[model samples]
Target: MSEHPIPDAPQRRTPGDEFVQALARGLEVITSFDAEHATMTLSDVSKRTGLSRATCRRLLLTLVELGYVRTDGKAFTLTPQVLKLGTAYLAGLGLPQVAHPHLEKLSAALGESTSCAVLDGTDIVYVARCSTRRLMTVGITVGTRFPAHATSMGRVLLAAERDLALPETLPALTAHTVTDPDVLRAELVQVREQGYAVVTQELELGLRSIAVPVRTSDGKIPAAINVSLPMNSPLDPLDRLDQVQATARAIAEDLDHLH
Candidate 1:
């Protein structure tokens, strides 16, 4: 009998490889469907991701089978079960877990609301929040999404965006919201230099807030923490801003050490 040829050694996995590439593509497809585009057709998914119709359909069907997505006749949307993926990540993040008690203490002391948020595209989604009281008419709960260009948390995160690109025309959430791109870009530059952001009544009337970037152990900013107060509250606005920024920096330092 002829001797069998020796099998080649398997290649070691690198950061960039076909397996990672395909997984990334699948994740992109899943994330592409959001609240606004919840029920998208295969053509819509393809258009949004620049993927072929067949590829989009295959991934969508796979996700549906995995219970991360659901389809009804002709439309596909993410299922509530999809949140488990993000929930697992948040649970694993030591910073959020460690910072929660501190954040609660700060909110109780200041009689204001505090939140931790990470940039998600052009929006900031609150991952953790400690609310002092139900003060605002427009309810803000954890996981709520807000425009990054109009909020202190968003600006702080945007300030860290290298060579920060600010759009010329931001969607106007309120009459006081900045719509001019140049002005917004200038503001972002100032925020980057100052290392924090303050916005007064931009998102909602009577709402004021300050935010600072949370840096990793490597000094890389991945998110922001913010304190929000009512505009009419007796708290000295300038003093509150200073304190919030200080607290955020302290928390960020703690996070750096933990990470």
Candidate 2:
């Protein structure tokens, strides 16, 4: 599956909206950069952020002055200082630490890549990952974000509780991508009822993944774990999927204890 940056938060009626609009725009500018787009020109940032070139340039220069980004006159790349934003988040979240070992063990047992991800707005961010080998062009790593509707982990997280606020149109990553919102909602409903999700060739051809929710002791689902492979399989491949479920349960137990 392809990776995407976290989308902007939806606008809402606020008591002091004007005071935070600039801050929100600045955050949007920073989030626009991702693994695929490390360096971007003013025009590139403008197009990606849908902001005017003047506004984008102002924001970029401000960030550069703040040492969050560096520029070679025409192109801009994030500096090491940018990591603080993500690191601050990971440092606060103990999910990665609790789940990392279990993910590694699961990957070793299954001989496949395993990851634990949580829903962050419209995307699922991989907080913990144990990769065996490259299954897709996009390598598995911590902080990788995938479209929620097209991934097993995403579906599991979406189906955990509450209705997902889907986009107006789902972007088609592959021929089998389910662009229909209704169909995806149906899939999410099934995933919620089934307690797991298996996605085949939806995000990429030949890539299949099975995911189960990682629940806390109080029955709160904060994340999902997945075992991904290259070959396609039947709809209900529960035998091989047992390992993933067991890993998830153990990780959930550890998370509960941590809390």
Best by lDDT: 2
Residue-level lDDT of model 1, residues 128-183, one tens digit each, is 78988765665566566788988999999887877666666787766788878788
Global lDDT of each candidate: 0.76, 0.84
Q: Lowest-lDDT window of 10 residues in candidate 2?
A: 4-13
State how far residue 34 of model 1 sits from its true place (Å): 7.3
- Candidate 1: count of backbone clashes, pairs at least 3 residues apart or interchain: 0
lDDT of 2: 0.84
lDDT computed for candidate 1: 0.76
Tens-digit lDDT string for candidate 2 (1-259): 4575443333434647457767777887888888788899998888888788999889999999999989999999988898888888887778999999999898887777888999988779899998888878887678888888889999999887585678789988789888898999999999999889988888788898899999888999989998888774343446667788888899988877877
* TM agreement with the true structure for every prediction: 0.70, 0.89
Query: Runs in model 2 with CA error above 4 Å?
Result: 5-18, 232-237
